[model samples]
Target: MDGGVFANLMHGFSVALQPSVLAYAFAGCVIGTLVGMLPGLGPLAGISLLLPATFGLNPIIAIVLLAGVYYGAMYGGSTTSILMRIPGEAASVMTCIDGYAMTQRGRAGPALAIAAIGSFVAGTLSVVALMFLAPTLASFALRFGPPEYTGLLLMGLFVLAYMSGGSMLKTLAMAAVGLLLGMIGIDAMSGYTRFSYDVIELADGIGIVPVAVGLFGLSEILLTAGQPTPPAIQRPTLRQLIPSLEEIKLSVGPISRGSLIGFLIGIIPGSAHIISSFVSYGIERRMSTHPERFGKGAIEGVAGPESANNSAATGAFVPMLALGIPTGPITAVMLAAIMVHGISPGPMLITQQPDLFWGFVASMYVGNVVLLILNLPLVGLFVYLLRIPYSYLYPAILCFCILGVYSVSNSVVDVWIMLGMGAFGYVLRKTGFEPAPIALGLILSPMLELSVRQSLAMSGGSYGIFFERPIAITMFAAAGVLILLGLKPLLFKRKDWREKVGLEDQV
Candidate 1:
């Protein structure tokens, strides 16, 4: 609400209004839609492949393009999930529950329309939230000591363990593995090589780009190759794409609730987007007057989760832009790109780098408009992409995955590591394990280590220092409660049942 903030933000609109930048934003959204429509591609993969191309752009322009692709892909992912029952990304999985069900029941058009509207609603609201809340949030983040951050990180990891939609033991195991992988580099403080395994390649540790692309993209290629060919999906008509007033009415409340849930979840350091979508879906069903209609093509079921995931994606940016801390792999790459350009993101970024901050924020609004324009007319086009043969798609997907990985350092060694990771990723997926928690752990591990080291330095190595701070103590207690509550299977099982019953009532 400060005059300066408003003025700077207005200045940002001036920059974002450029014809060239708007074109780039449009291009990014188009590319993102193509990638998101593909079963084996996700936002991370799409962004990685495009990173090198953005080097010539101004920081704001570059980030705007990247952000456009990020949000655009999220919109496109739902099309595939709804039409083909093949999610373009992990976050789109929740959409499949109701979206594909609607498809089978001949309501694919309505489902897609609702998702698009919901995303637009949620995205606009989240950006509005960012505009009002970001400065305040950044100011509060400035108050966090290393101990507080460390405590928060632990709390985040625990949230990931339960929120990941897998067995508690399995999620924990993945987190442990991810944390160890994260440690495989030169120690920042002692300058000691902890897990380099006598290999110089790991001296700088595994780059997140290669790791993410390998684990999600290449691995998905291998999995797709192994699966039987699926039937071709047909595109729905534009007329079918528009939702009824009653349907829109039914979805409004859920979308609003979803955005709220997603925004809150995304502020924490984890894969909150994916988890928040499912959580939103669950809530929508529970809150519905007729819960039993949920799995049978309920409009609320698709609207809430779709809106939630996109909103959460937007929310994830707040931490990265305001705190200089990457909360996930996508944002981690964005942070790296910013740093590579010799600009560090932090609390003072808004005041110190007004153009960079405001342009980025304003461009989000532009990106949303671009996404809505691209998605509304092109829903059928994206659905048509679902018909591309997997055999043909996998090769391109893998090649781009490799190209994306290699572009990070121009290292073939990274490609080799990526292949190995692909194998590992495939195995894990085959074994019913989720890769999101691992990715989350990878991003958070360094933060956790740095926080611990700084906290130790602050408290002169006192072990009790983490608990002494009121904020830290509160976070720790919240984490404990989350863990305990998450473990009560009977409780969640009952909750799930109640949600189902609630959905039935809405019908």
Candidate 2:
């Protein structure tokens, strides 16, 4: 590494090692693991719920805590998937296929051990990659103009919709709805209110916090209320937690490949963790000497997907921190959190807020160590949490959600927005519509509109400016390809489209 990069990292460690920052990191890790173990509450909900509580803290400390929660949840998700056959998050869905099978065969210990170890390896490696790549990407992004940004945002939305494992048309429609909702407040250029209906609260755009908490947190409680409880789990002894030497030898290849695949895929805009896990599972199955062993009790299956999921989670931060563009719903929430702290995340973020940027990066390394310790020795405690009845759990979660949303601006209006959005989200869930694209669209819409308007103003209202810039042209071309690829199934009426997209028979 360069001396400057090394120097910044050393300074970051100095900040992250402070007593208060360590406490925050520890607290975030614990809360994240608990939330990840709970069904219907993933990183998105976990981060959104805690966002209001961070308003009183320093921006660096707040982000460090939130970032810890983000990856800590990734670790916890595997625990539920293995012990109870319940995926705590969508990215852990592949883990259920093999992780539970290993548990059934009395190999739960090795599976859990391999998962923690692989995640540690991937998480640490990805953080190193982030430290180097984010700075380089930010420098490159400084060259971008309004037209380039317009094309990039447009492509980002399209890529997210394309990769989202649902109906393309539905996802596109949801993005459109989000864009319209984003335009509700006063126009930035004309200083005129568009859709506020003269409500004073509507003078500013809808708050992202309430909308996120409502859609992902409150709505989840309502949706999961009717689901059957998870099955009982048997805890493994400490002796059983250690994997055999042969199993360790078998896992190294899959874990390494999974890390590389996940990190690369995560740099793209979409649900990369979910996609990466599926990809890792497929690669392991194909490369296995005895493919028939998969879905029956394969250690490689458990190791590969878990590692990919964690690595991809780390990779998702690259775009958000460097380019100020969120790749998925979770990163969008993080973007909002950073903005709420009066810090704009973009090319200048590293130079202007090196302490915040590098300190947050250093915290990830510390957080990974914390997660390994938590997952290895305390795995049994998390399993016990799953036994709690949903009847009692849902009510508590609802109360927390209400309080968190209400606390944002201390306004009942925000609470109502949350509840209204919760009902809407629940309805959308029942109708097979994914809420992720809508969230991404809502977050990116203002930036999209501003970039387009700015480009138009600079080009004398000409539509050809997008094509005139090489970078913009490249981004638009990529967007066109993604849109076409997303529509291929409908156009060709392919029966195996889901399989091709890695969504076939997924739980």
What would the TM-scores of all predictions be?
0.94, 0.94
RMSD of 1: 2.8
Query: lDDT tens string, model 2, 1-507?
Result: 235888989989999999999999998998888888776677877887788788788998898898888889989999989988877877888998889999999999999999999999999999999999999999999989999999988887787677666788898898888788788888888999888888778778787767877887777788778688766787877788999999999999989998998898888777788878988887788789987788888899999998998999999999889998887777877777788889988888988898898999999999999999999988887777878887877887788777777776777888898898899899999999977667767777888899999999999999899999899999999999988888777889875344653336543
Query: Highest lDDT: which candidate?
Result: 2
Report the C-alpha lDDT of model 1 over 387-481, residue by residue, as the tens digit: 77887888888888988888878888789888888889999999998777787787778878999988998889897998899989999898999
Candidate 1 ranges beyond 4 A from true positions: 1-5, 490-507
User: What would you estimate as the lDDT of candidate 1?
Assistant: 0.82
lDDT of each: 0.82, 0.85
Off by over 4 Å in 2: 286-289, 495-497, 501-503
Location of the lowest summed lDDT over 10 successive residues in candidate 2: 496-505
